[model samples]
Target: MLSGFKLLACLLFSGQTPTENLPAQDFDEYQCSGNVEIDFPGLCALLDMKNIPAVCTKQPASLTTETEEEDTDDNKSLIDDSSIWPKPCLHAELESEDPLSAKNLKISGWRVDEQIVRVLQKMLLSLSKLQSLHFWQAGLTDQMLISLLNTISLCSNLRAVTLEGNPLPERSYHLLLSEDSILTHLSLRNNRIGNEGARLIGSALSTTRSANKNLLSLNLAFNCIGDEGAAHIAKGLRFNCALLFLSLSNNQIGDSGAGHLAATLAEFALTHEEVVERRKLLLERTQDSSLRVSSDQSSVGQLPSVPSSTSLSASKGENKAKKKEASKKEEKPAANKENPKSNKKSPDIKVPQSKGGKQGSKEKLTAQEDKPTTALNEQVEAVEIVNPLLDRLVQYRDGELILPGNTTLSSLNLEGNKITEKSLPLFLTSLEMQGEEGGLLRLCLQRNLFSPDCELYVKIKELMALRDALNKNTSEQTEEEEQGAQC
Candidate 1:
């Protein structure tokens, strides 16, 4: 008896493996046309089934090509324009109990259309746990690739991708480089990419943010890359340090292109060294500032509150003045009480001034006194302790100066191209451009236009010597640091 796994595997991947091959009964009910292979939604429906056995038992006759064509003709009669394309109204419903559960999808070598892309995008949107996607030689144009990318971007868990053998364009590069992409391993081998497409790929890789940071391996082999395309790629390498493996093999690269690439690498090495030093200096400064602030805080804690004594003194002075004023007021009131006739005379003398003046003066005095005390307290609290280290920490949190590490461009194959002594010199010059600690390890320049006694041979020897020296020096430095730490 066939299980659910076998049934789903059969629908998704037909005849790839013995287990994936559908049972005779199941294959007959698939409702696919003769050699057309329009089983995409049928496979999607299999993934959506709550009870595979129950759904598979009842094969709907409406899914047959005959019925579909008849439905299309019926819908076409209502419309005036005969040019309108027939829609694939097949539905892949969410019949499963768990809404979050989703299965990965892998389709290859299928003919593509606008309707197919739309249906695919809708199906991808419905899935929640799509991990990887592989589409090979699927007849994708620039617009189709864009549509696929837009749909893939919506899948949060999609990381690995293989889109080999598609005729992708420059715009496809832009879509892949978009910040929304989170692919880690992307292969575009045999894509027939041109100069503009290569430039777009390079530009996307050069992004210093999370966009291309996740990308580790990229395969651009079999793309016809000339000098112009090579230059743009070099520019991208100057800024991108996350990629560990890249292939440009089987391309139309010449000596000029090789030299351009070499120069870019050398320049990047020098710039990277300078950046590392600057970062170290800035880090040290931040650390020092942080220590200073910490010390200040500790000392502040140990020291007495300096404002307390002054505040107490001011309060005492105000209390003494208040006591004196009360005594004088008491004397005046007593004198008024003793002489009723004098009180009447005094009231007449004061009159309108006494009615409003005393109340206003008392209110003014109270407000003025409260304002000063509150202001003094606030001013003490407002003593801003500016910590430069804290500011740097904030910058780090905001993703400044926290770039991905520089990984050397590994696996360069410049096989079968017009390379001569002229290209050799430029390539050698580029190697010399590498800083003392450049990260170019392996290079393939075979089957190129090189003579036996070309000056490039001598330059290559010199570069090898420099590389050895750099490695030796680094090892020695590491040993010395270790010894010093022990001491």
Candidate 2:
């Protein structure tokens, strides 16, 4: 059993879509209290809500505070201050004629008691001034949602309502949302809304009644919006320009889904011809800049001024040398291609079938399941981007972008993004520009869900070799400088 555990253990230790796990010390310094180099590099688990490090959002005017009371019984109370939760910023009148009736809204989980009724009554009281309401995951069923929606419609102030994470089916939710003309910010994350729900949302977004003019942000991540849903959403996007940010992350929306959005953006640019013309102007300007630089480099040899400027320019020479060294290093990834060492990262296969399941019916995990692969072909449609900066490079978990640091490194592991042939040139160019010793020394691109023909593999191999050489050179230079200082 121990031996089997050893084999299957490696299965748990693999990279996801775009996060390449590397030793932490390579990028960050975490010296132990008493021990050095004890910690291996691992990512803090990056979920949707809190992956990017802290950025303070605006605090609501008031916060509900709860105090815990020592429970004499066996029950642990998780929702002590569930009441007094502020109303959703977007709200509407519930049942009261008083326009500013939103003074009492509960933020706690709904209990089927007098307290819950009091909270609902308070919310109902706020309907006159309420523009939106959100009750995400608080035991609100389909009937309850419909009832709330129906109740809110009576108030002219009710604009938006969010009942995300509840098991509200698509058809009923759509009709309700369509009726609310002033609703702009809708969150339906982690819901079972398929294509039907998306189109319904789309229909609501297209509305431009005198009462409801602009709808800005729509967050519908983690929905089951496959290609069909994306197309419906794309249609909504085509006609609507009032919306600014739309988050559709963590759905079944794939390359095709992205394409729909991209097409919509292109359509938007086309609709507003000024944007198209400006892009052309910018492209021309970039080409002109490159030409001027190339001309400047070429003209240097003919002038007497060249020697003084060129001779004293040790930093420029150093860059050229690094570029040359990096070019030489590029050969290594090609060699790795012939003998891809990364392919053999995990030979440790283990099988765990103990107390968790029926004894001895060990769950077998397949090598194919463990190793995901794709192949890019001539038929693969590549996205064309006008801005080189926005092009996808390496990314971390949850599609966060990863660029090589300002130095060289020894190991790299960038998973969570699909970087392929089209972006290959740009990626390499960026890596090259990063220099051989890209403050990041190691380049590890393993266990990513990229095409088998991912030229990035080759690019990483070359970058790694460059990183190794630069570190070697840097170490040597440091030693020489130290010796010179000693003398």
Candidate 3:
């Protein structure tokens, strides 16, 4: 029998060795369909990932985790190697588990590149005891996903993921989503994926709709997943009931996606309410219309005591007396309004309106008049949403400070104190703590703040480090200078 590791490799990469998963850039790297020969050594040489004798010191393929015995191991700094589980859903779940355990783990339902995916495949299979994972456009591919699936066919818990640029076929992604995932947060954004990819992922979500309810938040933005993709996701969400926060930004997922998602959320929220007013109205209109009893019955009134058989005669006698008294009083009212002789004459009385007529409607009309829209909700109509966060985070427009009117810079995080230089970059890096969306990572400082030193010195240094790391990982940076402060 093949070893578990080898079996996993065969399962994911169809028996391709790590040496065969290398990148050559012979054809376009974006295309997923091909049987191209890979030279792992050559690719590692081209990229600075190889740990070749004295020639290349950096380890190619992947980063290694330092693992120790479970309970007996007392190294406070060491973490489990996650190279053990390779399956997508299983891997994501396992990686998220022991949130404080794994160091570098990667798994999700998205388009993964080839070479980068091979490293992930191995990482998933070998580092069964891994800790955390941080992936931003690390060349994940289709065949490698198969390897990933094989590496981890079963898992219980997964931690978090940051996937931005890795691309995978839609069909494959949906298959991954089909698995039971325990991951709480997922970030998959900016990957040029379209509706087909979204449909696949949505299909997976629909399958694991019950178990994956553990997911608290999800970010799918800046991908080209338009209306159809968003529709599929909305339909999937109908089966999901536990999600709290969802971000679908810059996908060109226009009004249709917005409306569909909004409608779904509104419908779900209504269901959770104690008394779903709209649903009650709908139920009354559709299923209970024919059962309509007379509305004239006062919903609230003093209860009349039931008369026993012995008391029936007395009750009837009392009713007759009451009617006689009412008749006498009715006649006396007119007499008091007129002269003494004419006082005995009964006067013409106006008839009360029917419950189904204008008298009943007038009350409702008055209620409606009193129930005007709140000043807060309607007063915001003039406020245009021109991505205030963008205007705030990106202060330099043509080398000038262009603070849009009424923009609150989230990066500043100046809630209880005045902002200074040291506090800003701490706020910016805080965003990096919020991992990937499309495997295309863009740090959001609009939601954070950096100290002036951070804005000037610290952030520049950090940006340079970020750029070096990202540049080392992938050749996707075209305008890295704008990453740091310009103004």
Candidate 4:
């Protein structure tokens, strides 16, 4: 038995069919971590190995020891070295034969030149199965990102993406908001996605019918999002429920913006919990229905056939055919009515041919008569200078509007904002609107303009430390460093 098994193993390993035993190969990860020059051809070969899923390569220079680094006292930068000694175009040899097998790719601190950028783009274009990607400190810029837009859209299975330290422009980063994208985790740390980008992303996230409904984490740290942008995001977040973790650190959020975010967090939680419960109920109902169908089948001693793709297609075709027939029936009366109208209009149009001069003069006279009425309407509109402030209950800024008793936000990060005593009352009122179940768990109010002895400060402290008799914690942490001087 042992000899027979050995023979079978040898036969399986052998290429009897003139094809490699790709299915038997189990190479899943490739890691290159050393100071030596990376053999790009060898790396590509390893990645092309059957079933290889992840590839990680740290820059060789970063791994060099101090002693090894001191030996080369040349002041030439990576850019300068690349320019001076250009590597041979190894595109043919370096390209992966089976790039689609790669699911995760992580390349850190790469000295990306024009040629290398092209190679990277080509590699990404080939990776149809790629899910997660990280380009940390890769010298990536706005132009580079813009170039990869089409390639990025092709990655239908992509869920998580990190572009840390890349100088991504608004146009480049806007690709993330594509309806085809099913991104669940997006990190744009240190990328200069300004207020406009933030607004765009927020709007996309708010679309519950979008593929982004599965999105759970979003990090926009170091972006230049301000009060207006924050408010826009807050409005969108009120409708979104799938998001669990959000990081908006080092943004230009002010009191108005902070209040808007806090309100959203306080109110959005309830809706999120409700959605979870609804999904659970739906699953239970589906399972019960399946069980009933199985039970009915067993009792009848006949298995009821499930609808196949062909049957479904045929049914759809029949429905379409019926709808077409019904449409044709409906169109007959409409066409008859339109025929009479067309006949009458044709006569009226033809009658003008005999009295063209008179018709032209009459039309000109009507146009002249309507000119004063149009001018009068414009004057009325100009005279009525509507006060925008009157339209709102709490007037803060131009575009930062927050609705109380209508959010489900639980965690809020409004640190380093321009919040003062004046904004505190409104903020507290909004929090109270959340009721017992909607209290904020985390509130960051550090480096804001607030007096120590002010009533707002005292109230804020009280709200942060709110507890129950059973020692059930409602709030977790409140970041309130007194770094700023009292106003």
In model 4, what lDDT does residue 305 have?
Answer: 67
| Error at 32, model 2, angstroms | 62
User: What C-alpha lDDT does candidate 4 achieve relative to the native structure?
Assistant: 0.48
Better of 1 and 3 by TM-score: 1
Clashing residue pairs in all predictions, respectively, total 1, 45, 86, 11
List model 1 lDDT by residue over 372-403, tens digit each. Answer: 22222222224432211111111011112222
Worst 10 residues of 4 by lDDT: 388-397
CA error at residue 104 for candidate 1, angstroms: 6.9
Rank by lDDT (best first): 1, 4, 2, 3
Model 2: per-residue Cα lDDT over 345-426, one tens digit each: 3221223335254322322322211111011110111322122211112112111212222121122222222322443444
Query: Which parts of model 3 are misplaced by more than 4 Å?
Result: 1-102, 105-129, 152-157, 207-211, 268-487
* Candidate number achieving the greatest lDDT relative to the actual structure: 1
Model 4 CA deviation exceeding 4 Å by range: 1-104, 111-131, 146-158, 207-211, 263-409, 436-440, 451-487
Candidate 3 residue-pair clash tally = 86
Off by over 4 Å in 2: 1-108, 111-132, 156-160, 207-213, 268-487
lDDT winner between candidates 1 and 3: 1
Model 3 TM-score (2 dp): 0.35
**Which consecutive 10 residues in model 3 have the weakest lDDT in total?**
407-416
**Candidate 3, overall lDDT?**
0.37
| Model 1 ranges with Cα > 4 A deviation | 1-40, 43-106, 125-130, 207-211, 268-407, 425-438, 451-487
